[model samples]
Every structure is written in C-alpha cells, then in structure tokens.
Target chain A: MSQPGPDAPSQPLRITVLTDGDTRPPGLERIEAEADVVLAHDEASLRKALPGSQVLLVTDFRTAALEAAWDAADSLAWIHAASAGVDQLMFDALVESDIPVTNAQGIFDRNIAEYVLGMILAFAKDTKQNVRYQQDRRWVHRDTETIEHKQALVVGAGSIGRRIGTLCRAVGMDVVGVARREKPGDETFSAIHAQSDLDTLLPAADYVIIAAPLTDDTQGLFDAGRFKAMSPHARLINIGRGPIVVTDDLVAALDAGEIAGAALDVFETEPLPADHALWGYDNVLISAHMAGDFVGWRDALIEQFAANLARWQRGETLFNPVSKRFGYAPSSQ
Target chain B: MSQPGPDAPSQPLRITVLTDGDTRPPGLERIEAEADVVLAHDEASLRKALPGSQVLLVTDFRTAALEAAWDAADSLAWIHAASAGVDQLMFDALVESDIPVTNAQGIFDRNIAEYVLGMILAFAKDTKQNVRYQQDRRWVHRDTETIEHKQALVVGAGSIGRRIGTLCRAVGMDVVGVARREKPGDETFSAIHAQSDLDTLLPAADYVIIAAPLTDDTQGLFDAGRFKAMSPHARLINIGRGPIVVTDDLVAALDAGEIAGAALDVFETEPLPADHALWGYDNVLISAHMAGDFVGWRDALIEQFAANLARWQRGETLFNPVSKRFGYAPSSQ
Candidate 1:
C-alpha cells in the first residue's frame, strides 16, 4: 500500500451506507471526523454529498445512487456495505469497477446463530402454541418433546452455521454441516456433508436449517423435490435469503405432510400480500425477518464500518471482502 | 425413618392415577411388578381394588374418583398425585382424611424454568411474528430489545420460581425473588421480596413472571391494581395456576397499554371457550397449561416415582409431603 507522495493532492473520503434507517449510524460521525464528506441514501442528501467524497460505506448496493452511478462513477473509489449479504449491492457495483467492496461479514454470525436456536426451540417445544392457549383461558396439559439428541442438519458451514452448530452442540443435539468446500476443521459438527450429500442428509434430519448464501448453485435449492425428501416429522427453518427456498415447494411440502412444520422468517416478498395461502396453514410459524434484530445492532454495524474504514485507509485486504469465486460474495458471516 | 417391623402385615398396593389425558407414564412395569392391583379412573375396578390395598397413587386426582371414594371405608391410607399443583385436589379429597398425601414437586422445576426462558426469549425477540411473516412471504425487519441486563421479578420462590430465577441469572439478568414466606436459611435467593413488596418491585422489572401456587393470598394476585403498578414497557408471564391472575385485569392492562404484553400458559378454566375475550387480544400469548409437557418427562416421572416408592415401602416421611399446617391430608402419601 503506497501513501500519497508529497506533491500529490489529497482527496476527501466519500462514505456511503448500504441502507440508512431514520437514525444515522454513529460510525458516520467517525467517518465525518476523519474525512471531509458523508454520502448515503436518503437520496437527495446523498446527491448533495457525493461530489466531494472518495469512499462509500453501504450496507446494501440497491440504493438509487449506486444504480445511477453504475456507469457514470468517476470520483468514487472504494465501496463497502454494512451487512453480510452484499449481493444486492456488490454485483452491479463491483463487476464493473476496480474499486474494492468490503462487507460486514462476521457481524451477524453469532447473532443469526442465536436466531436459529430461538426458532428451533420454538418449533420443537411447541412454544408458540403455549402462548396461544393461555389466551383461550384453557389449561390443557399435554406432553411435548424436547430437542435433546435430535438429528439436525445445517445447510451452510459459513460463520452463522458454524456458530449455530456450536450452540446446538451445547444443547446435546446431533448435528451435521453441509458446504460447497469441504472443511475438516469443524469438530463441533458430527460430519461435514458435501453439497451432493444434501439428499442423504435430508431424510435423516429432524430439523433442516438453511444458512447458506443464495448463489446460482444454491438458488431455488429447496424446491418440491427436496421437500419430498424430508420426513413428515421433519421441520424446516430458513435464516438465509428467501429465494433459497422455492415458496410453492414449501407450501406443497407442508400440504403433503412431507414435513411436520416450518418456521420461516425470510420470504420472497415482505409485508406479504394479503392473499397468501401459506398464511392459512396450522403448522407454519411466520415471523417478520427479525431473528437477528436486537436493540444494540446499530453499534455492531458501527464497529464493522469502523474496522473496514481503517482497512480502506491503509489500502489493506479487508475482512469479509467479497469472495473472488462468487460473482456476488454476500454473507451473514 | 425405621424399616417395617418384622411383625407388620404386608398387603397388595392399589394405584389410582386420576389424570386428564388418556395415557400412561413409561415403565408401568415397575408399578405392575409391585402393586397387586392398579386402578385408572375405573370406578368399579378402583372400588374393588381399594378395599384390600394399603397404598394408593392418585394421579393428579380426577374429581369424580375423589367424590366416590370419600365415603368408602378402604384400607388404603396414603395417596400421591403426580403434580405440583394440589389446590383443587386438596379441596376435594384430603380435607378430612387421616391419609397422608405427597406431590411431584421438584421434578418439573428445571423443565418449567426452561419453558419460562423460552417465553422470555419469544416475547423479547418477537418469535411470534417471525413465525407469522414467514408464511405471508414477508422478510420483515425491525430492531428488537434483549434481556441482557434487564430486571426480572419472579413472584414465587418455590421450586419452579427459583429455577426460573437461576436461568435468568445465567442470562445476566438482575433477578428478584418474591414469595409468601422468606426463610433465613434459604440462601438460594439473591434478593428476597415479600408478597406485600410486589408493588415496590413491579416498576423496576422489565419482566414480571408469576410462578406462584394458587393460595388464598395468591389467587387473583395480578388484578388491575397490580398490572397498573408494572412499567409500561414491562411484560407479564404467568406459568402458575390461572386463578392467580385475574383474566379481566390482564385484558385491561393490555388494552390500556399499561404493559407491553403477556405470555400466559394457564387459566381458571379448561378448554377455554372459543369466544373468550382474552383470545381477541393480539398482545397476549396464550398457551394451554403445558409448561411441563417436554419429551422424556414421562420417563423422568416414572424414575422419580420408583425412587419414592422405595422410600415409601420403608417407614420414612415422603419427600414432597403436603403441608400438615393446613390440617388436611391426601390419602395417597
């Protein structure tokens, strides 16, 4: 990494956040303090701030600014998103430019792992129904099965998946991990199943969790055929992207009793349309994609951006850089 | 604590398990191996078996059997119900009998404690809506709060309540235990609050969990006045007997936004009528009285009974005896 020569002109660092909610992240203050300008979504404001900046801190690339700047970018040199899934922002921004795009990959790993554990506990223990019954003023006592020693299959060996495997191990569950590249280092997993082993793993798992990224190889992965491979008592939980599971296939799986129940938080569309049939099912538990949402999450994202900022300034290889192999290297790392 | 005298006469033991659900706990072979006769809610069979048997195992006391046996002059003296709650059973069968009674008190403490933690996580993390949105094809996103350092008021320092407090402590929560009686030798509690101190403790708690038995003082405990005392951001969870909390007060609390929400798992009634007003409230999480329904529970109970049986066969006082202070005794100790 070469520094600016004595005669070279210094440039104002440009910062773009992938998605900006109502409150700006505190990381923005750190960026502003160290640099000259801050550019982010809230479109009009980004447009005004864009010309004077040189670095962009984005959590996603779907911003209209990124779309508009795809072919016209001149001053923007470095772009980073504050999330694991950079596919939405990185593909269009990165394939076209030599500028490096870093993502906040490791931030959500443990958090999302906790989310998966929460959903699994809810489903296996029949937790939500207990809440529903008390509302009816009924005291119906019944036996429910716990998760101890149950067979579980994790579809991804990424950071979140590995963390979930560790937590599952703590609860005395038998776990297997699946991935594109076989890794022998995962001692927490009973065995690392390859992508081709998914079919073999499906029938044996009492619970199947989707934690993999959505790639061409992974997209539309759990369709009708895969759903049929599951046992009627088996349950499916998707913490990854929505398209990774074909919605109709899941509905059919539930309908045919190929699976006992589903706890889904990610879907193809959100604020879901009023007339969705999956809403009518008894065995399904739908949550707004809030598993990884905790109050202090803003601080986590801020820390990620702060670290990436240091890396960008030093011109060093950043943590969670988009993998060169995947065209869109997004992660819930 | 003396063993049976050499001159003592031995006779067949009669076991009557008066439970709601139509099932048997595992390892019934042990009971059959020792008991000369078994009675399971069959009035004629129980009548026949009761006259000669010396011991009775009352399975949670079905009311009809209690009514029929009150007048019977049976040799049976001791009765044991496989439950922690003994209010209704005590009222019906043990008020005048010289027979001793015991209960399955400590068996469910850990499991129910785990259930309380499950509810807390569900309430704070929004597992309810997570299940709802997945079916609607929505990837809903929102910030959620955690219980890391929040204050929890556990309004029962009995076995189940203490276990809940322990689990909460493990999660880094500030725990306060409240009960009718606070013994000096009871070091399990970090801080003790009397029943009268509930109001003083309510405002500081992010969660108010009711795990108290239904006593004269505890019945209708969380009436409107108590709900009003809680913080607006607080959540109320009841895993104790239903009458302990006045249902109408809960509704009013939720309606007025006096508290964030509630998770209830028990009620005064069974099979709550479909039209109950409590069912209409969206903020309430209702579960049938099923906090003790985890898998392997039957086996665990059977093992407990077998150990207790060995003690009972000898002339030792039972481990979970009903309070003799009240002057009434169960016939199946």
Candidate 2:
C-alpha cells in the first residue's frame, strides 16, 4: 500500500548498490546510464552514499552495512533485495519504516526444488555410502530403500515448496504440504494442512522437507519436540533459512537416532566451523548454501532486479512485495 | 508356442532348484506340496537332479553350473530364472532347444527406474563432490546444473527403460527411447528410435542410460566409438548388463574426457576387483550390482516365479517368455 503512485519524479532517480566487492552484478549498465548510481563496498561507503538516494539495491545479503547506514537515508523510497530470502535485509528500522521492499523470489523456485529432490533421492539411493565404499575400494552390496509410494511432508506451501511437492509426486511419492493456512489439495499436494498440524504429520513422513521462510513464528520450528515427533526412518532436509532449526538439538536428535539423517544446506553459523559436530556424522550432507545457484544465476538475479527497477521508475506496483508484518510474502494459496 | 495343452498331467510335477547354498527362496510351501522338489547346490547335484525334472527354477544367477549340467536335462520342459536377466541361462544348447525360458521382469522395472533417475540427479547435482568436500571438512560452494528441460536418451525401450523414461519425463526432462525396432513416441518419450539411431541421438543427450539386456547384439555395444559419439557434458548410466559397455573403452573415455562421468552398477567383472582402475576416478560412481535390489526383492522375485508356476500347473501361457533367438524378450514397445 505504500507503493508510489503513477507520477514520475521530476528529478533523475538515485540508486545505491551495496556489494561485498567479490563480483559486481552484470547487465547493470543500462540502469546506470539513466540514474546516479553509487557502489558502496563497506558500511562507511554506504553511509556516505545513502544521503539523497531514493532506492537501495542490496547485492550483499550477508552484510549489515545497510542498517549501520540507515540514519543517512533521508530520501529513500524502496529497498530491493538480490536474493529470495530477505532475512538479512529485514532490520528493525526497515521493518518499521514506510519504505516498500521487494525480492528476487520466482527466479529460484525451480532450481531449489530440484536441489531438494536430488537430496531426497540421494538419501534413498544411499549415494554417500556408495562414495565412501568406492573410496575404500570396497564392493559392499547393500539393499537400498525405494522412494516409490513413500511419504514426503514439505513444510511451506509457497512457490518453492509447491515445486518440491510437484517433483516428489512426479517420482511417485505421496506428498503432503504444510502451510501457514490450510488450502484444498491440488495436483502437487495430496493435502495441505496448517502449521499446527506438523506434529501429527511428522510421524508418517519418510522425508521431511523444510522450505519455509524465516519469520518470527517459524524461528526454531524444528527443535527437540519436532525431531522426536518424526519417524526414525525419516530424513530432514532444510533448504530454508538456518535459524529455523536449532543446530544443537539437531545434533542431539542425530545422536539419539530420533531421525535417520539430515541434508542441510543452511546453518546457524555458515562456512560452519571446521570442528562442528555435524561434520562428523556419516549421515549428514553439508552443502555450502548453493542450492539455488545454478550456472549463470547471477545474471538471472540481476535481470529480475532490473525488471523490478523499471516498474519502480514508472511508479507501478512491484512484483514479490514482501509483507513486512510477516517477514515474507504471504501465500496466495 | 511350446507351452503344454490344458490337460492336467496325471503324474505330479518334478521341479529342480539351482541354488548356490547361500540362501533358499522363501514362501514356496504351497508349491512344494504339489511338486516333487529337488534342491541342487552345485554342478554335480544339478546334473544328478536334472534327469527326471520337468522344470528348473534357477536362483543363482552367477553360476555356470546350468550350462555344465545341460546334457542331463533330458526331461526339461521349462526354465525359470529368478532374476530379470537370463543371460547366464542362455547357453547355446538352451538357446537352440525347444524348451522355453521365463524371467522375473516386471518385479524390477520400478525400482531400477528409480535407481536410474537417482543417478541422473546425482550427477547433475554433483553429490559425489559434496561427499568429498564433507570428508575433507571443506566448504566449497559451486554452481550445479538444472535437469529441467534436459534431454535423456534411454537405450532399450522395454519395460524397465520405459519406466525410466516415464520418471525422467515426470521431472520435466525431454526423454527419447531406443529399442530394437522403432515405434511412435508415447506419453513417456518424445521420440522412439531404433538401435541404429544411437549414433545420431548420442550427441544431443545430456544423459545416456543403458537399460538393454545382455545379448549377442548388445554385447560390447558401448565401445570407444560410442563413447566418442556422446557429448563431453553427458553422463553415462548403466543399470543394464555389464558387458553392454566395454570396461577398457570406458576407462579410455574417462582418460580422454570423452564423457562427463559414469554411474555404473554393473561391470564385466563381478565385485569389480579392488585393483580395478574404475574405483579410482572421482567422476565415476561405482556401485555393486544392487540397483534393482530393494529390501524384500528376493521374496518379490520368488513371488513372480510362484505366479508363473501356477500358470505352468494349469498348462497356460507363461509371462515374460524369452525370445531365445534375440536372447531377451521381444519388447512390446
């Protein structure tokens, strides 16, 4: 509702790009040609460049520079994130501000869904064991479980979660989705339940996938009680935000055999310290949080931002507008 | 055509079982009640037991004792293999005889298809690299390939291959099937080609899956030339017989970077010796011949044979009859 009306500003638009200086987003020349653009690589630079800027284009999702420079933003109208999850950008001031926020959401759904399915199949076929045995030059013939007719419970019935459910069902899995609000089942999900029903749903799931956004209600969602509710034969896959799961409790669950295993792409502490206990487990699959990053993904993210920027210049409603109260775009499902 | 007429035999059926003495097939009490059963553990036992038996049920797929005891099968009316591939039972004398052979075909189609899909997804996602990184406790972020709209070429458009095609298509891949005879494409495949079209189809496929049976025509089907024809980005998956691809040529292909990688479940040599070079490649995934061997698969195989036995008792046509001339069942595709 805070989106600007259809009246173009008389002055030239000013945009500030906060980057980490690793790689600059490509295909931004056209945007730079018409606007006064400033690339801020650090908090001091961001603070220096924030004054007189109407748009903040955040390329570094890991930096807290924007919040540190918030007092300098005297004329900011909007904030645009280059990533799907806008958790890093949702500081207290921004959440309480009148500035509207948008994100790169639809670009990542398919690739992330594919990544989740790959992890599910990897566990079912025991690919990691195959690698370990091959390394030892051992030919151990083991019987693996079949994914067919197995149950998959995906938490988060948003675009990414629905795509995960669709792919799981494609491979003959009985898929059920858990959303914040209940909806009628479609081709992808056999049923959709409210978040409160997760406890009852966990016991029958062969694979429990977390694709929910990071929100106040979802933080620490997969704690001790949730893990204990899961079937011991189930695997936990978190492609969602890291803090949604308590790391120590997950370690304990793995130690006690409360769950079969976990394929974690995100963590509370990233580049997870060398001596982290999760690294020592044979069943854990640790990825470097690159689930949605396919080849040429940087360009795709930039393209999405550029399109949304065009809409902003003309004072039109934006795509993927985040609901500040909920910390994510509420589902139309 | 060799099946007996629908007239109940006055004498009780004499059945011989060829086993390697490891484990006996379960759930045969009902069959044993109506038949004179003899369990043969070796070549000498098989020869001694074959003189009066009208049916031979083979449980040991790797044994050559059947060929050694062929001369003693004077009263042989039918042969049933407890495995999908009847390659070991297809000796010259058996192939040249009027006696019919049947296999456990339909029992393995879905599981094998699932295995093939898992391998395809593994290579696309770089799961082996994740395992290696986890072993070193390193966090290496890398972009992976998306399987959506990728092309998959399936060699051998029989029940197993068709199932693989169907599953690949379910995940949004463009699938093509290869068979002995060309047929119009169905819901599973975008097109169907004859065996001769493999050369043209090889270059375009992102994944080439071998699901053909081991036979005179298919033996050494993938040699140096076939490997050269495949795209450098393509990964080869073999869930079919081992000799379908030449191991030495595969090694050379890897050395020359002819193909991206291979996920081999079968090899020309069983237990793929510890000294074999295939075990050393980071890109190659070596799995013991267990692609279709899900939990309870042994019982499933026996169950298929039992159903066939019931039909044999009623003098009706058998399921999965081998062509003998082609060394496999002529596919209905």
Candidate 3:
C-alpha cells in the first residue's frame, strides 16, 4: 500500500467503486468504460484490481474484509467515501496514512435537516397515530398545533444547521444558532450564540435541533441539565451523531416531563437494543439513523465524486473539503 | 344560549364559539370570564345559542350547525373562525348578512409552509420508514437522496406559498411561484408564473407544493391532467385543501406510478374515510392534515387575535381580513 497510481493513463484515471449491490449511476458507466473500471463486492478482488486504480469509492463502511483489502492495496492514491459523518471511515490506521479523504457533505445537509423537521412535525401532529386511527376508520377530529412564531435553538451551526435555521426562519420561527465558538457579526441569525448560551436558549426555545458534527466538544451536549432547561412543552430533534445526546439522560428527561417530546434518528448504538425504552415511548420518534436514505442516494454521491474528480483533474480544490481545524488531518485523526 | 352576564355588565354581547372544541387561546379566558361565552356543539344548540350572540368563533365544519347558527342569530353582528380557510363559514347566510367575519390567517401561513417542506423532505429521504424500521430493530442502511439544488414549484403564491417558496430557495432549490393572478414586480419569487403555466413547471419541478386557498379557481386544480404532467420522480405535497387535488386522481396517480410520492395533510374528506386507498399505499404519507401542529399554538393564535382585537377596538382594519371580492362582508370565519 505504499505506491502511487500509474503516472498517467491513456484515458482518464480509472476509478473503482465498491458499493452495496447498487449499479453505477447513469453517466458513470460511460465514464468507467472510457477508463479501467472494475466493480467488486469483496475486498480481495478490489485490492487485486486496485494497483491500477487512482480513486476507490466506498459505499459501505467498516467491513473487516474491506480493511484487509485496503491493507494490501499498493497503488490506492485516494479514497472517496459516499457518506456524510465519515467517523466510521476514520479508524486509526487509515488516518495515520497521508491519503487525502473526502466525503459527500453539503450533499446531505439540507436533506437531513429536512428529515429532522419532518419527524418533528410528524410527531407533533400525531401523524402516525392519526394514520393508525384513520386505518381504524375513526373520525377522531382534533385541533392541531404548528411551529410558527416560536423560538428554535439550533445546536451545531454547520452547513446542515445553517440550512435548517434559514428554512425555520422562513417559516416564522425565531432561529438562534449555537456553535463551539461564535463567529463575529454573524447576525443572519437572531444571534449566533455559543455553547455557553445553551442555558438561556434551552428554556426559551420551543424546538431544539442538534445538527453539529460529532466532536469532543459536542459529545454529551444534550444531557440531563440541558434537557431540564427546556420547557416541558418543548421538543428535541437530533440528527447529529447519537453520542452528542446522552440517551439515558434523554430518557430520564422524557420520563420526568422535562421536555414535551423527543425524536431520535441516530442512536448511541446502531439497531437500538430490543429492550431500549426509546422504542416503546409514545412521544419519542425513533429512526435508525437513516435520515440520509433516499432512492438516488448512490447516484447523488457518485455525481458529487464525479464533479470532484473533474476538479482534481483540472487542478482545482474539491467542493466539500473538510477543514483540518475540525481535528481531521490527513495523517492524524 | 342567550343570557345576561354579571361580569360583562356593559351592553353585554353574548359570544358563542361554534367550534368542535378549544377555540380558547391564552387571553380567551378573560373574554370568557367577562362575557357570556357559550359553546355551541350541535346544529340545534348553535341555532338556540345564536339568537342573542354577537360573535361566533367557528373552528369546525363537521355539520350544518354554522348555517343554523347564522339563521337563528337575529343579532349576529360578528363572526370569527379559528381556521385560515373561511369558505365553510362564508356562504349565502353569512355573506348576505351585514355580519363582519374574520379568520385566523397569516398566523399559520409560514408554519404550514414549513410543514409542507418537512413532508417533502420526509418523502424525498424516507424519514418515517426509517423510524418504523428502527423500531423493528433494523440496522438497514441505504443511500438517501438530497434536496439541495432541486427545482420546486409552489402553487398559490400567497403568504403560505410565498413562504414555502422562500423556504425551498433557502435549501438551495430553484423555486417558482404560481398564482391565480401574478403580482407585478413580485420580488419575493425568482420567477412568478401564471397558474396556467403549471404544465410547463410541473415537469421541471422535483417538488410541487400546494399552499393555495380553496377558492373556486383553485378547487380541483390538481386533477388528473395536472398529475399526468408531473415527472414520475417528483413529489406532490398539499398543505392546501384536499379538494384542490382530486383525491381519486391522486390515488390513481400513486397507484399508476404517475408520481413518486405524496404527503397529504388535508383530505377531501376530513378524518379521511376509513377505506380510502390513500392510506393503503406505502409510498403515500398520510398526515391527517396536521402539518400545522406544534407546541405554543394556542398562545400564538391568541396573541395575534389580541393585537387584532385591540385594532378592532381602535376602529382600525384587521391584518388578515379576507378580500370582499365575492360581494361578501369580512366576517370572522
């Protein structure tokens, strides 16, 4: 795994994408046909074919065989992961290498933010319960509420958070952004409050949305103290990393009526345990961290990588390059 | 229904709220505590209650009780409906009379728009399915589509539609607004198109959101012809009245794969009939018309009404008074 790609190919540099049983996107097959394209399910064959490959696109994450294949790849120059929140891709060994890594970031920001808002509205409007009742054919007429003219304290003002805040603000909700560090004169928001303002914002906000990237500062940010500060009628929606919110603390908060309701997309554990209290709770909406799922997902990621490839070929910077300041260096995690 | 109140000892105006329930906002109790407030449930009760009542706050359209209430009320000086759509409240009886009618408009406009965006996101990214799958303890991971850079077409470029357009634009979507009559030099929209231009926009849009009122022009606007013109991948979300999109046409569209998905909050039939095929489709997300549901709803509505009430007392016009184009007075419907 110590060599670079062939100095130059007769055609464009060949790119091999090992995805989860999904075909190459519409235009990608044509691109691959022009280059030395190889599709593989297992890592051994992909690695065997990797010496000629300049780009390796991964759709799935963290398989032992894939790791083994990566270990043997002699000419794998760079890896393009087709997922947001590439924490799973950043193992010790991979980060210890100088290989530049890129992810589909802005691609999923608005989509995921919309997903969070969807769950909030769905739960608040008793959409599922109403559907169940409608299935039973009940004319159970009830007055509904709305998310207008209410305060929304959005934690983690990243790309997704900015989009979420803008959308929420357009809908008449007062948007307050909270980040690790405050930016200067950022008044597009009512105020760009830092993490310290959580106490003041928590109690006042009708909705608290978590959309920050997972970091040391963000881990366990939504715990008992934060939840308690929220009004009993307030709601919490987290699309960020699961550990950013302490699940046990959230459960206690919900149990004690510290907050009105909560929705979880990402969990501290994947495929949350069968006995997890979150599944049975009436107010809580639980999703399997699949807020980023869609019909043309692979195609979208491929399109992004394809664009980045053009940028790379033209000696231009990538579209969504994660900055080194976020504790992500090429050779260090 | 008619009685002299001890508290409102001035020229007492008996106010009857012709609602299913809970038209009471925060400051509503003060009016109830002062004036003779009556809850009219059935047509007979409403008829009996309206004789001496001055104001009727109607919240439901379940029965012909409103007609009866209007018929029996000799001194019916004013009426207010708790919903934005005042069609059910304004008819031959209330329209012909000199009664002043008002509605809760501009209140839920943006919030409802946000809900439409949320529903769009939900369908585009499969949020609810993920939630259900998570509950079943599935770790199934899949690629999701992105909403960024999509083209959205908003129908009925009023307050709600405009808000929905802006919200969509904020998420990097190119949004076009459609209305009955295009307002000249409307800076709120990127491209203001006539309602007739829907056919051209329908095929280009990834999302078609209906936030228009249930007017004669808009009723059954999204019928079969319109549905057929839409791309099979595009989603249709109706925060407008259900009748706007023929429910049967929508069902046919969904079953025949004319469109990708739909999130119908309002229905042609409220508490959408038990055996409706709309509920049976996996792709269709039935929201029981609760896109406007959120916490702090009552307080928000009340505050708006309070401000309007003060304006009314000061002999000033209200903020969201319905247009008197149909030879009907502005009755609070």
Candidate 4:
C-alpha cells in the first residue's frame, strides 16, 4: 500500500469480469477506462485472465466455474459480487483463503422489501381471486383478512430481511426475526430469536418470510417439520433461494391443507417446468426469481459496483464485506 | 337535555332500521333488549315505523327510500347509517332538518386504506399480469415498478382518504390530498390542495384514488377533461362511490390509453352486469363493492353504533355526526 514516488506511476489496476455471456455489463465504461478490463465467459477464459488480475468482478454471480478457475488467481486481492447474495462465490478455497469478499448488499434491500410487502398485501386482500373473478366476468364478494395486528416471522435477519421487517411494521404488523443468535430486536423486529427458536416462533407467525442467503446451514431449513410447526392459516413467502425449502415437502404441505397459501418467487429449479404441480394450485402464487429486479436495476447495480471499485482503488475499506465463514455479511458489519 | 328525577322511568328509545330485505342486522340482540326495534323492508314500513322512532339506522346503505319516508320521521332526533358514506341519507329534507346524522366512520378507515394500498401495489407490481402468467404456466421475467417515492393523489380528505394517505406514506410514497380547501398537510399528506387545484396535481400523480363521498360537488368529478389532465401511466382506484367517476368517460379514457389502468370496486351499476365492457379489459380490475367489508365488518359496524347509541342515551355528543350539506363527516368534525 506504499505511495509511488514523484517520478514513478503505479500500474493500471487489472480486473477480470466473469460474465455469463460475451456481452459486458451496461454502463461499465467508467471501470473500463481506468482499469485493464478482461471479460471471461467461462472457466477457461477466467483462468487465463486471472493470472495478472488484481481484482475479480463477478457479473455472472451464480456461475460455478469460479471454483474451477481458483488456482490461477495469482495476483487477485479482492473479489466483488454484483449480487447481494455471494452464496455461489463462497467455495471452500475462497472461504479458507485470505482474500476478502464484498457484495451488492444494500442495493436490493428496499426493492425486495417492497416486493415482499406486495406479496403480503396481495394474500391478505385475496387479490388473486379478484383477478380470477374479473376474468370470469363474475361478481364475487368475499371478506378479506387484515394484516394490521398480524404477526410476521422473517427467517433471515440480513439487510433484506430487516428491510422487510421495517416495511411490515410500518403497516402495523408485528414483526419478529430469526438469525444465527438471539438478540433484542431493533426498530424493525419486535424480537429477534436464534435460529433454534424457529420451531416455537413458526406457530405464532401469520406470515413466514424467507429472506436468508443460500448457505450450508440455511439450505433445506424449511422442511416438513418446519411447515408442520406453522399455523394452518399462515402463509409462506420465499424470496430467498429456492433450495432453502424442500420443494416436495412444501407441495405436500400445500396439498394436505397444512398451510393456507404461499407466494414463491424462487424454486429449486429455474424456469419451473410446465408440468410442475405447484403451478396448478389456486392458493399458490408463482413468479420467476425477479423479486428485486426493478426497472433500471442494471444501471443501479453498475453504479453500486463503480462506487465500491473506486473505494478499492483508493485503499479505503470496502463496504458490505462478507464474513466468509457465515457465507453472508453479518449484521454488525 | 334535562335529566329525569329518580321517580320518573324513561320510555324506551324507538329505533327504525330501513333494510332492503326482511333480515335484520346480525347481533341486534344487544340493541333489541333495550329499545323498540322496527325492521322496515320498504318505504311504507319505514314510514309507519318512523312516526314514533327517535333513532333511524340505515342498513341498506344505498337505498333511495329514506327520502320517500322522510315525512313520517316526526320524532326523529338522530339518524345513523351502518355504512361509512351517508350520501344516500343526505336528502333535501334531511339537510334542512334539525336532526343530526351519524355514520360508521372510523370502522372502515383502515380496511379501505389497506384495500387502496393493495390496489396500488397490484398495479405497481403488475400482479394481475403475474396471475395471468401463472395461469398460462409461463415463467415470464419482467421488470416491475416500485411504489417508493412515487406520487399518490387521494381525492377526499375524510377518515378513509387520510388513512389511505397514511398507508401510502408508510410505504414511502409522496402523498398529496385534494379536499375542499388549501391547507398545510399533517402526518398523512405532504399538502392538501383545494379541489380547484386538482388539474395541476393530476399530471404529477402516479396513482389517483377516489376516496371522496358521492356529493353534488363530487358527482361526475372525474370526467373527460380531468382524465386528459392525468398522466397516461397513472392508475385510477375508486374505493369510494362509483358515481363520482363518470362511467362512460372512464371507459373512453381506458380505451384511448389516456390512463393506464383502473381498479374499480364500486361501479355505477352494482354487480356490474356480466355483459359490461369494463369486465373484458385486461387492464381493468373489477371486484364486487366490498372494499371495506373485511370479515366481521358487520359486527364492527353494529358495535360502533351501539357505542354511539349509548352516548346518545346519556345526552352526550354523538360521534361521527355528518355535515348533511357536505354528505360525509368533514375533517373538522
């Protein structure tokens, strides 16, 4: 971190961008102007570019090829994810290495919170039935439930989960949180319980929200036993990774009327097959994994990364650095 | 207003309920035990019951028979409407009469506010389209709009409108209200503009909610000229009376793409005929006129009246008294 002498100029920062396709990120001109920009579509290209790169910008955030190309990162100092969740980037080697990781943490918090609120309101108002009735040209009047004093249990206490809790509380819902450990809740949650208390908390929650990152401990967290612990009138909302819930168990739970309804924006499989049983249920609301993808979000994502990149170049501490062992940024950070 | 001496027993309070059908309001046992309860199914029955009644409760909230039976209300001291809006009861005779009218005001405020918020969110998230996509078994990924920082214009500054503004502000929307006069806004609206300033406000509003009651001044308020003044991307949500929005003008506006969409719970015609053209639009969301009728709402309405009746018997100031000329309870009241 030594400053260069008056006669000498530092070398340009070399950055390898691991992309899903050949196309580069939009509005990445600022980054490209001052750095050596290497776009890699796959593991072979990423490996070839990694030797001279001082930083890795993961634009293809979900690719598994980063682990394969890890051995060639001879000059890599920091790794940045263009997404909030760095689940795919937390490999055994990366977690065990001295390299620090940062993610686009705060970017998706409010957007995802809004999406969750919309889902919650949609369920409470029976909006899906209203749409169906409109299509049938039939006038059906049904009394709706209110969320004013209802309880919401947010499964994750990350930035996204906290944002969800804040908005829920703003609309008069009593929100509680589940995290790695128990703590007194802040302005968002009434109380935050340890993950171990989830079974006891599940029964009281009128709405259970999954906003955790995909991790070894979180994957398959809401299985048959967890669903059984929830109230029959409770609704399950998953904006987190799909693998976090056992799909078969959820299907069984829905079929048996063990749970009232679910609004899932993610599934274990991407682009759920047309024959999927979940698609046929009237009580289940299904959407592609797009809870946080608001219009102009790409530009916002690039802007967030640009800020972080500038901070890295200046040797200032990066924001949203991940706690590698936990696989997501801890609340304290 | 003088209290009777201990030796004088007070006569029972006679109440006439103008109903559209023979069935009386549920849980009337509490009221029937203390008073002379008359269930009138038509104008004739209401006329006969009204001669000796001191209290009149309108359960068929939209009936026009109140005006026809007005002459027989010789002993009437106060009128109570089970529904929130007192538009139907604000007849020429009633407006000039010394009798006071009370409505079920606060009972529907939060419920209607939730409904309006639900409609706003449904439009912002393209929830109707999402439901359609799910029905088709298609995994469509489209960027959605966010309500945060968006502008909302709520016409009517009564309890329901204020509640709507409060909820919209809770979700980070910039809310402005349209009322009878210009005033600095409170906790709900950023500003409350007089009705004369609506044209200037319309162009900036992302969502226009008609929460005003049906009065002479408000009837046919949203006409062709007003629609033309609105942003093309704006949505109209009417949880108030239907006649406030001219049906033909609204249809034309939607057809011409002058407005993006509408969520109409109240139509000029109830149970909006199956053959109505509004039923076929992909952008129009139609529901039976039950926005504020959450489960147990009837009980809530009855409970509200029971409390007000107790106050009336004790010669205390009645709650939710209407300004007959204005049709609904003014904010000052």
Q: Tell me, by TM-score, which candidate is best.
A: 2
lDDT of 4 by residue, A126-160 (tens): 99999998888999988898889999999999989
Scoring model 2 with DockQ, what do you get? Answer: 0.84
Candidate 2: where is the Cα deviation over 4 Å?
A1-10, A331-333, B1-8
What is candidate 3's local distance difference test score? 0.70
List, in the given order, the native-contact fraction of each candidate.
0.60, 0.81, 0.46, 0.83
What total of clashing residue pairs does each candidate reach?
A: 47, 0, 21, 0
- By lDDT, the candidates rank as 2, 4, 3, 1
On a 0 to 100 scale, what is the lDDT of residue A126 in model 2? 93
- Output the lDDT of residue A105, model 3: 71
Error of 4 at A300 (Å): 1.2
Ranked candidates, highest TM-score first: 2, 4, 1, 3
User: What part of the reference interface contacts, as a 0 to 1 fraction, does candidate 1 reproduce?
Assistant: 0.60
Task: DockQ for every model, please.
Answer: 0.36, 0.84, 0.37, 0.80
Q: Give lDDT tens digits, candidate 1, residues B224-255.
A: 99999999999999888888988888888888
**Reference-based TM-score, model 3:** 0.76
Model 4 quality (TM-score)? 0.95
Task: Show pairs that collide, candidate 4.
Answer: none
* Predicted structure 3: clash tally: 21
lDDT (Cα, tens digit) per residue for candidate 2, span A1-333: 232423436756788988877777786787698689888978899989888788888888778888887888877888898877888778899899999988887778888888998898889889899999999999999888899999999999987898899899988999999988888999999999999989999999999999998888789999999999999999999999899999999999999999999999999888788889998899999999989889888888878888988888776788889888877865455
